[model samples]
Target: MSALVIQTMQPDFVESFHQALDAVARERRYLSMLEAPPLERLRDFVADLKHGNNPQFVAFDGARVVGWCDIRRHDREIHAHRGVLGMGIIDGYRGAGLGKRLIETTLAASWEIGLHRVELDAHADNTRAIRLYESVGFLREGVARDAVRIDGRFVDVIHMAILRG
Candidate 1:
């Protein structure tokens, strides 16, 4: 309803972040889980991310978190060039191009931080997300068959990646 503010996730915003994540997870469409962690656990995790080298971004509508995008790079030296991506948008925000903005901003930050490749996995049925990733130069790497189990059913996951040029 207000102008979206895109920025890095801050420690002070943990509770709102957790609630946004939990709400998105319950949607059972974009994410793989049906539940999210409790507030304290999420706070500690957020604290660690804030202190770590990984790059994470959040879209805020005034005080509420509307979307999030994060990329966690590998720790081992040989794999440090690669980072895994994850993101979600609230129900009211889909199809309005917020996802495109978030992914582009996160990838730009990832490249700036020396990441060479950013990877992500999406539910095969999530065409909207797949299109968003593809529009940003992500290529279909492969598919992990039945990689997610939800609502007593298994779903395929499409693995995609974008390599920095």
Candidate 2:
């Protein structure tokens, strides 16, 4: 219950960050990963993210990463004005208002990086996450039926986006 600090991800923190992500992924709740990518591959990926224009933020409790969020911009010129968002928080930190901070920080960073449209998809069953996104101005655009398979069953995915005014 110490102060939580939010900052841009750095190369040196990739391993711990990956471990944190894997822990959340294994919970079988939000994300669909059974295990995260190997350390070497994830290290390179994080390095690449550092070089890209996309903005990523990590919330830390001292040295441990409790949450992470990022906006990955489309590469093509026609789609470059938009970005896709992804985020996850460790199990113990779910309802403490950390998720809101992460999303808000990412949205602000998205605008700062010149992105006008930001989109995200959440499992339709994930009401808490969908509510969080909506509270921050994201609107449901459509639903991709059976878009995710979790624990052997399909789940609808809700596509949501927020356009800069």
Candidate 3:
């Protein structure tokens, strides 16, 4: 693999990004999405992020996207200081500190855009992710019992957040 490059999302990355996201979502173990949305929809979503100045970062090895992290700010006036984060790393990239790099990059960008808080939900079974969130200063807020059904199996969701000064 070439040197891993992490950068803000750009138009040229659309297709590879979509493929990477779809691969992770299809794993059915971590993210809420059992499968990725259509490519056009993903394109629109990335456009919205760019237009809104929301933070979205993609990690790549040469031309292939390996992982991504994004934080979308709330639209309501009262919630404007907050953003929700979402991220995923493809199979081969999972435990090598890539998630840390992607998330911290996105979080720094989020703070720059005047967001004071960032939130995320993780599958209760994803302890590795939970620990990563904690390392980045996110505190566990609460858990929703059986909040989702994946593959006919109920899963609890842990809500967590981090506040910036």
Candidate 4:
């Protein structure tokens, strides 16, 4: 596997990022919640990065986008020290360590921006994602029962978080 180049996302990369995310969403049944935001929304999301409110990163394999992660700081004053994280990788790129790199890079960026903790939620049945989060030091916080309805079936969500030291 080629080494993934982890870097901050740029506005120009939005289309490719959306494409990669769409591919992942289609292949990973549990990631159906991942959706491509409209171009305007994506532009706004990218703009948020400039103000240090939303931090986004992309993993590239020689110019092709393979994975992406976003860590957005909470807007609530009481929760300002924390951020919510979201990640997705192309199906063909799984198990290649790209996810780990993407996550670690995002976490590092979060820490650099003064966030004390980062949280993420994944479908309970997504064992692969759970293991990846665990490997990166994110502890399972709790489960939200019947949190999401997918294809007429209810799926639980596992809340996980990692604190920066």
Candidate 5:
């Protein structure tokens, strides 16, 4: 892999980002989707993120998206101070500190935008991601038992959050 760079999500990255997302999702062990949503949906999603200045980032190798981290702010006024974070690194790039860089970059942007809280849920079995979240100051709030049923198996979901000072 070439030297990696992380940049805010942009309209031009929609297709590559969609491919990267689908690659991770198809693994069926990480993301909520078994496949990426429609390309048009992704295009609209990118447009919304860019227009709203939401904290969404893609880690790239040359022109290819190898990983991504995004914080989508709540739409309702009552919850506007908060956002839900999501991220993934393609198979080859795991354990190389790409996740850390992607997350920290996105979180810094979230703070910069005045978001008061950022939250996420991870599969209970994903201990590496859990540790990473803890290292970044996210505290475990609760466990949603059997929150996800995928491939005829059940997994608990760990809910966690970090607050901006």
Candidate 6:
């Protein structure tokens, strides 16, 4: 495995990013709550990469993009010190520590931007993700009951948060 290079997302990488996301979405059933957005919507999504103090990062193996993570600031004033995170890695790249690196990089960037806490939600059934979050000091704050419907069944989501000192 080549060294994973973490960098800010660029416009030219949108298509590759979308392809990687689609592959992961189809395989892991981790993000089953949402459908893959259209290319145009992805363009808009990428356009908001740095909106309102939000930052997005992409991981690459040589010239191929393997994963991405985004940290978006919370909207309310009371929660202004915190942010929400979303992440995904392509199918073939899982279990290679790339996800951890992606998350660590994102958290480091978030802390640098003055965010004191980062929160994320993962499906309760996603034990791999849960363990990874726990390994990085994210604690289970609560459970959102039936928060998402996947494959005609309601699935609970585990809400987790990591605070930076």
Cα-based TM-score, every candidate: 0.96, 0.95, 0.98, 0.92, 0.97, 0.91
Error of 4 at 44 (Å): 1.5
Each prediction's whole-model lDDT (CA): 0.89, 0.89, 0.94, 0.85, 0.93, 0.86
lDDT of 3: 0.94
RMSD of each: 1.0, 1.1, 0.7, 1.7, 0.9, 1.7
The best candidate in terms of TM-score: 3
What residue runs in model 1 are displaced by over 4 Å at the alpha carbon? Answer: none
- For 18-91, candidate 5 gives per-residue lDDT tens digits of 99999999988888889999999989988888788898999999999999999999989999999999999999
Clashes of each: 0, 0, 0, 0, 0, 0
Instruction: Give candidate 5's total backbone clashes.
Output: 0
- What candidate 5 gets wrong by more than 4 Å, as runs, is none
Clashing pairs in 2: none
Deviation in angstroms for 66 in model 1? Answer: 0.5
Q: Rank candidates, TM-score, best first.
A: 3, 5, 1, 2, 4, 6
Better of 1 and 6 by lDDT: 1
Candidate 3's displacement at residue 60, Å, is 0.2
Provide the lDDT at 106 for model 3.
96
Tens-place lDDT per residue, model 6, 117-153, is 9999999988999999999999999999999886678
Ten contiguous residues minimizing lDDT sum, candidate 1:
45-54
> For model 5, where is the 10-residue window of minimal lDDT?
45-54
Ranked candidates, highest lDDT first? 3, 5, 1, 2, 6, 4
Candidate 6 lDDT trough over 10 residues, lowest sum: 27-36
Better of 2 and 3 by TM-score: 3
Off by over 4 Å in 3: none
